[model samples]
Target: MAVLMEKKFPVEAGAYETAGEVSTTIKRTLKQLGVSAEVLRHVSVACYEVELNLVIHSDGGALTLQVEPDKVTLISQDVGPGIPDIGKAMTEGFSTANEEARTLGFGAGMGLPNMKRNATEFDIQSEVGVGTTITMSFALDMKG
Candidate 1:
């Protein structure tokens, strides 16, 4: 599989001031690449959700974007203080976000569910103290 373009955005924990910048940029990048509207919508939503997760939870992380001939991939890798229960985390309305995040009108606990709903493919792996990683892929209409 050949990648047509790729970029990575760094995210810092508690950086609510610029939480959605990455996703905004990702959406723009996809649009510039001529990605279909449907695929762009899915990627943008999932990207924002995962980006917010990094801002609220991870010590720090990077969100990578890769555009292949037939797909667009987003991989989020974070450091330390990983999830304790993936099942519970995936459940709607369950959140461990701090007051800062909640105060900012975030941490509704719908991040994971929204990501899964928007992405064509989604996978998450987390450890007690080793941090978490999530990968999502959106299939594109390569014919166009």
Candidate 2:
């Protein structure tokens, strides 16, 4: 599991103005690396969802992209205030988004659910006072 490439992008909470930049950059980077379209699409969607969660939730954190020979991994780690109930958070249409986020048409409570749906594998860890971390992996088809 040697990493071929890696990049970390810092995300600020409530930074709606720069919300999708990190994910878009990740998508472009993967495209330039010749990743398969299916994998790219999955990564792109999951990546965007995680990025948005960072902006809308958490205090601030980093989104990391790791590219290996057979898979792409996205690690999103954010500072407090953390999720107390990960199960509830993962449920579709369940969100703690504030009115501002809703006004921007950003938080539909679909972030975690959508990320899990798009990624090949998904895991989330959160501490009420510590922070939250989400890891998602998309398997690449290198056979082509």
Candidate 3:
């Protein structure tokens, strides 16, 4: 009784014009698959947060979605200038976004926090000069 679906989308830094497209597609796909509305909202928020992180932070990256009957998984992987201190980065309201990103009403430092809040489980890893990866999962039946 398990169903599986997977998808991947590319995200370019400073791609404001198309920043949320991937997340939107993911939302649509989940809706078509009959995912519950609550689960869909959580997935949509987390997906957009990760997508925006790539658009505003990384040089480039990919957002991946893996949906199973019990849970939905999101993995965001990006290249270059990785976080030096994940502890600080995770702190709500902490941001390192550039002026351009800030000017767009983004970079409020809410992306990571929002992602964590929306997902049932969350993990992040980074290496300076290398890259970063964030993994998040939402339980399909939970009241989250």
Candidate 4:
């Protein structure tokens, strides 16, 4: 389906200074669009998690926001140095984040797990030396 509204934000690697900015914008946009509170909260959490993942783990990436009549979708696609094991990456508390990322209070390893938990539908694909792509959707309906 065609997107009703869309925005893209570039996430620089290790850019802790500006982390969560994209997600903040997304949350505001959804609120302006009159998305339900429950769905907005879920999308906010998922978007923050994914955006932080891009800053902490990726070489660089862009987060895309798509709004449809029934749902909001967030897609994060990063450059090289992709994940080696998708299964391991999905595990809570399992993070490949470096000391730099960790020192900044990031890399707690909850990014992927939290995103999956908050999103109505989540998908992640990665290939070593290639890139990683994560897609998360939050439904507009009040029912989970």
Q: For all candidates, what are the clash counts?
A: 0, 0, 0, 0
Better structure of 1 and 4 per TM-score? 1
Which digits, one per residue and each the tens of the lDDT, describe model 2 over residues 92-125?
Answer: 9999998888998977899999999898889999
Those runs of model 1 whose alpha carbons end farther than 4 Å from true positions after fitting are 142-144
Q: What is the TM-score of each candidate against the true structure?
A: 0.95, 0.95, 0.95, 0.93
Superposition error at 87 for model 4 (Å): 0.5
lDDT of 3 by residue, 25-89 (tens): 99999999999999999999989989988998898999989988899999999986799999889
lDDT of all predictions, in order shown?
0.91, 0.91, 0.90, 0.87
The C-alpha stretches of model 2 lying farther than 4 A from their native spots are 142-144
Off by over 4 Å in 4: 142-144
TM-score of 1: 0.95
**How much does candidate 4 score in TM-score?**
0.93
Per-residue C-alpha lDDT of model 1 across residues 15-121, encoded as one tens digit per residue: 99999999999999889989888788889989999999999999999999998988999999999689998999999999998999888888899999999988888
**Per-residue error at 43 for model 3, in Å?**
0.7
Question: In candidate 3, residue 47 scores what lDDT?
Answer: 95
Name the weakest run of 10 consecutive residues (lDDT summed) in model 2. 135-144
In candidate 2, how many clashes are counted?
0
